[model samples]
Target: MFFHIVLERNMQLHPRHFGRNLRENLVSKLMKDVEGTCSGRHGFVVAITGIENVGKGLIRDGTGFVTFPVKYQCVVFRPFKGEILEAVVTMVNKMGFFAEAGPVQIFVSNHLIPDDMEFQSGDIPNYTTSDGSVKIQKDTEVRLKIIGTRVDATEIFCIGTIKDDFLGVINDPAAV
Candidate 1:
């Protein structure tokens, strides 16, 4: 799931950046420092959309840098349990397969796959049905439900399953 929320941060600006165009410099620095960063509470910060408020700068006694309380609107991606998402298969092995949904990495254990599908090992490993109709391999797009989530300070990992109806392979890159 993606969310557009307002967040606050204390941005420190150097004495040299206190002249004209300071606001632009601060905004650019905020984008560089905040974008692509993941927090346990907010998931992954996708983009810094716009600035909401910039509070008065506070100057320290000795340090030449000034700290400003900044509030900004941004977009974030957060996955939750029971959320169905379409992800691209990145790797396949006997144990299971790894898929990526946006910035989140999902692991689908072999047991979570349908019972009718069997794992086949080869130059291009894959899981396929007995009839060879449905195949899940590298670059395959699958619809899976997130069973669990592990949110780290900087990364988000998920356990997913494709055993339910209407879930599983959505697109095969090889078939294209």
Candidate 2:
């Protein structure tokens, strides 16, 4: 059958009745439902499939494991503290700067930005400003420390502090 034709046929039906029908159809197909004599509709699921990224150490998230080779789920978490890692600046915020390394956006806190660098309006990650306008410089690299994390329903945030050498600008011999 054509898609639009099917949609048109459904459109002719009553909205409330259509909704109930759809719900019942889904419950019957996806869930094992029983219309009991007195208990009313009882839903049961002995098993289900095609949930997408579940079971056997595979995480629902697309990212792989932190330790390497062994893959796991991604959530707002800190796998290792004070671990030295390299990252590029993706964004700047009042609270801190977020850098992308692997699948994680590590945070470099405000106090972590070099104290010698002047900031406008006390902005965090203190960007170099000229003529009263703030321009974000791309490709700025910094080492970060895993300090905190904020996990959402779908994404994981690794908050960090750049207050130490391991989290600050790394000495690059090539830059010299």
Best by TM-score: 1
lDDT (Cα) of model 2: 0.44
Candidate 2 Cα outliers beyond 4 Å, as residue runs = 1-79, 120-136, 174-176
Tens-digit lDDT track of model 2 for 57-166: 22224443211111111112123445666678787766567787655567766676655444444433446535534333346776677776555443446677666654
**After best superposition, candidate 1 residue 98: deviation in angstroms?**
0.3
- Give each model's whole-structure lDDT: 0.95, 0.44
- Model 1 accuracy (lDDT, Cα): 0.95
Candidate 2 steric clashes: 0
- Estimate TM-scores for all models: 0.95, 0.42
Displacement of residue 23 (Cα, Å) in model 1 is: 0.3
Error of 2 at 105 (Å): 1.2
